[model samples]
Target: MTDSNMNSHELELLIAAWLDGRLDDEGSHALQNALRTSRAARETFRQYARLDAALHDVADTSAMLDLTKLAAACVRPSSAEQSPTRAQESSDTEGSKTERRQRPFMQQMAKGSRVKPTSRKPIASLRMTPWYAALAVGILLVAFLIRGFSVDEPGTESIADLSPSEKTINTDAFSKVSLSKPPAPVAVLSSVEGVIWADSQLEVGHAFFEGESIRLEQGEARVSVGFGAEIVADAPCSLKFLSSDRIQLHDGEIAVDVAPWAAGFTVVTEEMDVVDLGTTFTVSVEAGEKAETTVLRGVVRVHPTKIEGEPRRGLLVSEGQRMSSDGKGSFVNVPQDQDEVQKQLGRLDFGVTGPYRPVDLSNTGQGLSTGDEDLHWQVVAGPAGVFSEPQYASVCEPERGYLPNDPDVSQWISTADWRTALPNAVYTFRTEFALDGYDLATMQLFGRFLADNGIESVRVNGNPVEVQSWVDNVKYQAFGDLQFRFVNITGGLVSGRNVVEIDVRNGMMRTGHVKDPPLSPIPNPMALRVEWYAFGRQQGIAQADDGVRLWRRIRDSVPPMSMLSYAGPEI
Candidate 1:
């Protein structure tokens, strides 16, 4: 039949026959015509191919083919097309034969259906042309018979020996098999800081699909690509995730850290393409004006967009090197601004840093564990007047001294000296700090403290923060020097003013008597020495003025064409 005259049902049958290597030349031509002219027919063919492929993986290859019954089912006239007479009676018989042939073979085989010998020839004897042979071996196997088959081995029961119920085929299995591809996530929005998207709303942990585009309006966001790469895009940036290892940056700045396994991760721009070579790099595009590529670590291949009739060229940018596009399909070397590179690098490295300052402690409070009226730190819940200077004796051994004066951290402040704070008591120290013009979602507080005895618990903004060492009952006593206990603060931090409360607990002396304790038993100090290692935003969002200045610098510093090197096309 011609493609125009073939209905969907007929086309499906032809597809099945084609998959089974049973389609005649006329049917093949018609099927090809239908597939070419009708998208629905092509989709149906694909579904059948998928179903056939799945069946090939699980279907028993040794099963016998019931060619006569299948052909009869395909050619039999429907009851609606015939009258209730002798011809109708023959049609009813044919209908019953078709019904029997449609039953699932496994169900009938399990039910021990009767079997009878068939005069039909075995599949090995059927003549297959080269086209049919190729179709059977390369494209689709004859899995259409999975639901309708018989055993043809010698000394074994034939399908004829099975009961009538076993003779039916289960064509429903074809309709049940799924053919569509599953959704794949190419990346995840791992972190968001004061972000405003131009279109749809997205939260942290949102999965990104291929070809998904995002516009960062006001803040920064980080995406963890599936293939071992990460992207940190600053505000006013637009990008499209092309795949796990590639993306298209339309405008603004983005830092990409490609793991070793994802060495070829590429960032496409309007004027160039930056291909990573196991490195961390930054790509900035000024929307139709210019594009810059800076390699922070390792190396990257910077390919300027090819201009028609011009030879393709790329530059290998090593660490501490920067390249810029002239907005005319050419690239030039620009001064590597280490300061800007470090700033972007800081934005990518959000991990905590050391010597966290007490919210109330002044910058001059380093080394001392005791808080005075000048400091905002106050005893809110525990005994007062226990604060004292930290003094470690030789018996205290290691962890005796305090961290030396450092600009990064504030002084250690305790309620009192360890010798006077030996009693079993809990001292809650409260301090307050204000968070302004900062991205609260990206803020993280990390620090280590040296207490006389141990820390009971810690709370931020009145919400309890987890202290695993305390939960595990690990002691936090500082013997001599600054063996500080680590604390990570991720939640309970809010905008504006925030409160931090540290509950310092002084355990009872190991010796029963607190007074005149043996030298072996060191005196317990009730001091709390906290050093703010790193707090708040490790890296601030790229300012608009900075971006403008960057483009201006690139424009001013563009070297003469003679000074630029054009390496041949990337291999």
Candidate 2:
């Protein structure tokens, strides 16, 4: 019968026949079509296959005798060497005497006599005996009894009597007899920085279950949902874990970093659902106002929630784009502020306490030292053009304004005494750092520096950066008048090793004096003070590339007796 016309009873019979190797070609075709088109049919087939296997196991273990050999032995016995008529003729006189002499045991058994053998005989030689036949009957009986006890009872309804759906229910129940179910955690709290939960106390490495709500009162928290998706939730935020790949942002802001394999990671808000199309993005909810989404890298699709009777289509927001949506289904493009977004990304405080220390370019407080065997800062160029021998800058106290001092966090360093340095001459100082185990794409390198006598230019890894120097003039500024120049060197940094070059120009001196000379008569005093830190998300704990971990190590390494400190930005 065709699959469409076949009833459940018919399908069950066909499956049973197939399992028993008794199905016809038509039934086999119908069963195949049913299994291909219907899930129930396939499940039934699986259950039948399992039952067939169990029956075969029972049969293999219990029935070891070869029935064909037993039948051949019974029909053609080894005693057939003499003819029946000759044996009858020999029953009297000379023939009887000959038979008695040739086959004494056979003649005695035919005369209804009980004969006892001297020794035991092999089973092959005793196959045609009455005792052997009786033993075979007993073995068959015991095998049937064992099978009857192991299988269903005599009065119970067989599988053929049950409907297809009922059969599935019974089979499923049997399969699940030894199975157990356990609740699965959807995400884990990988890192927490100054986090204060609203009600419950949570620590780092906490596992979160689906449908669980988290209310953060202060600080940043990062949750690692599987599939390489991580969510960093800023304080005053409330969120719910919907699943491993999705979360609902009730309030506050959260930045999501989706690895390539986690493209469908989604952030749900009241206004819209921000689905990652393989990107890094931030989603924020303004209570009842609107939801804003900013894409830092890659792309995302912002699907607005339905409002009243209106259905809205999703908007594609690419890298460096920001979009905001009102709960009423209105979408507007907002100007993207990448720097602010980057600062938010930087705030992810992975509490990595590590073996890799932060790169220090300062003159004091674990900064560039003169007595160290491995020096970081070297004077590459001076008044003599190029130094034949490597010249290392020595830490020195500044004669003028707030130059880094021994008591401060960073100290000033110069190649020679400022008084002896040539006027109008430029000195280039270079420092090298290695980012051995960091993820280069997400690394953030930023710091500040102060220079005396003015800095002309700054280059990172031989590439120029658009950084404004704190002082550009050769003239001296008043004490406490020096300002620190902030530099973000992320764009110019390389993966393994990096170099930073700073060119400081000395002021021109004047000969004869007046009240205020056009240039200072005394020789120009040149010194440089630098304090910078490099940060990045480390790939592993042992690699020493975790920015926060390295930062903490460098900060904590400072002596307690000293007044210097290396505190990072507050969350």
Candidate 3:
């Protein structure tokens, strides 16, 4: 009889989407039933609905003050006095019922003389006199005109005066606003506890937004966004706050749990500005460059301007699907390996298929010939498909395919110095290899790439660090003469020099594109937490033949992580 619910944001969203426009529909009925039946959920639903209406109203009317005064009466006190019930404030309360009586949607919703949601009918009609209503409508028109939107950038809309006593949708305002140049910088949006400040002190001359994610201009932040909020950051990028939970990326990657009815938000950037949206997806922006969008659950429409020519297409990604553009399409999806990362970083309680193999360098169970050169590695975990698996990261000689300096350069990087780079995760590194300047082959394996740049932290970057990477949800195949793409990021920026130094380790390469035989039996499916410091510090390889000597030392330095997925609660 009672199932008091709503443990997270996703549940709230599910209820919201179900009751969205047709507040009188079956979904609404079910949600309302759930709310009314459970006292705890009743207030919770009311609060969420209030916030939703506020955001909807803001979106519906982004004009300026004088013009804004004419917006939906919900913003004005006078109208509030005349209207009863916050329910009427909802966008669900579309056009007047006098006209709705003739509307097909209404006719279908109504069952003859006995109309459903008759109780809601009163609120929709809670109007002032015809003259005042006319004035309100006129204001609504103007509200769409000069609302607070930037006009400094190219392609933006303009607002005109309102004459009061009109009931027009003023669709033209959308076009103007959509086509006009970007509005001048107003106060950055502060929603759901997310704020950004890029003032004089912060001289971040270059900031880009491609798919759906946020890139900081300068200062740090403490943000808390709803689930499925996407954002990206280009190279020359670093986000070290007290905590980075609930944040998305436009150029890099992030994972979020966007509950069904809950809203999904994305931050897309190109090189100078950041755009925000609500949807389920991941955003990748080239470091300081382009943007890409990948949709997992909902649609994410992005644009520097939502008008014609300036770019009108948006990536419409859905379940098992993806859409992209040259930094155009706007959709969202959680990034790869996000769940596993969360487990390792946040120490979250998670699940995994067994055969719990540890990630020690020791080759115990794995039968590897002593001093075996020429190794191979591959990633295999999809047919059963449990979590978001990362692609195989490969590392090898920098041959003609990926370098320009020397194809014979060995020990691409000073392993002795890798510990000095101080990576940001167990995943960031830079090794040195001799690669000649040549074009990439028609085929190239690309996915998630990480490195430990001779330090305590690891760097995580995916293939094809461009906006399209996020939009397409795949690595870009390059066909260029050998050069280096050393840094791979979710935001999609390739900086530094020759890329041969950071080739994927065996585990990092994809199995489907297994060009090399696996070096040895894939030891642990789990991501490793190397005591890079101790190991690299001693310049000692944990040789399998070193018997228990190496395993014991390696085991003591770090705890075992899930070999299945490379991310999860921090150990």
Candidate number with greatest lDDT: 2
Model 2 clash tally, residue pairs: 2
Model 1 stretches astray by more than 4 angstroms: 1-183, 350-571
Q: Which candidate do you rate higher for lDDT, 1 or 2?
A: 2
Q: Could you give candidate 2's per-residue lDDT for residues 1-571 as a string of tens digits?
A: 6777878898899998776566777877889999988888889889989988766433322121121334544644354353333223324355343333222243243455755433322222321122322333344445667787332221121111110010011123335221001112445566777989997777664656444578999988887664447678899999987554688898999888876766888898878889999888889998998899988889999888755676667789988788987766788887677787678557654334221123334433244344332256777787774334557777765553343264344667777555456555678888887877665543445445556556767899889876644343322232121244445565676678888888876654321112222332224567776665444444455344233322222221211211112111111
Query: Model 3 reaches what TM-score against the true structure?
Result: 0.19
TM-scores for candidates 1 onward, in order: 0.33, 0.33, 0.19
Tens-digit lDDT track of model 1 for 30-79: 99999999898998899999988766422222111221334544565565
Over 4 Å off in model 2, which ranges?
A: 1-182, 308-312, 346-571
Q: Model 3: how far is 54 from its true place, Å?
A: 30
In candidate 3, what are the lDDT values of residues 192-287, reduced to their tens digit? 112243322222211111111233553233222212122222232332211112222334433222323334333424321222233344445465
lDDT of 1: 0.54
Clashing pairs in 2: 90-96, 364-411
Which regions of candidate 3 are displaced past 4 Å? 1-174, 177-222, 226-257, 264-280, 287-289, 294-324, 327-571
Model 3 steric clash total: 146
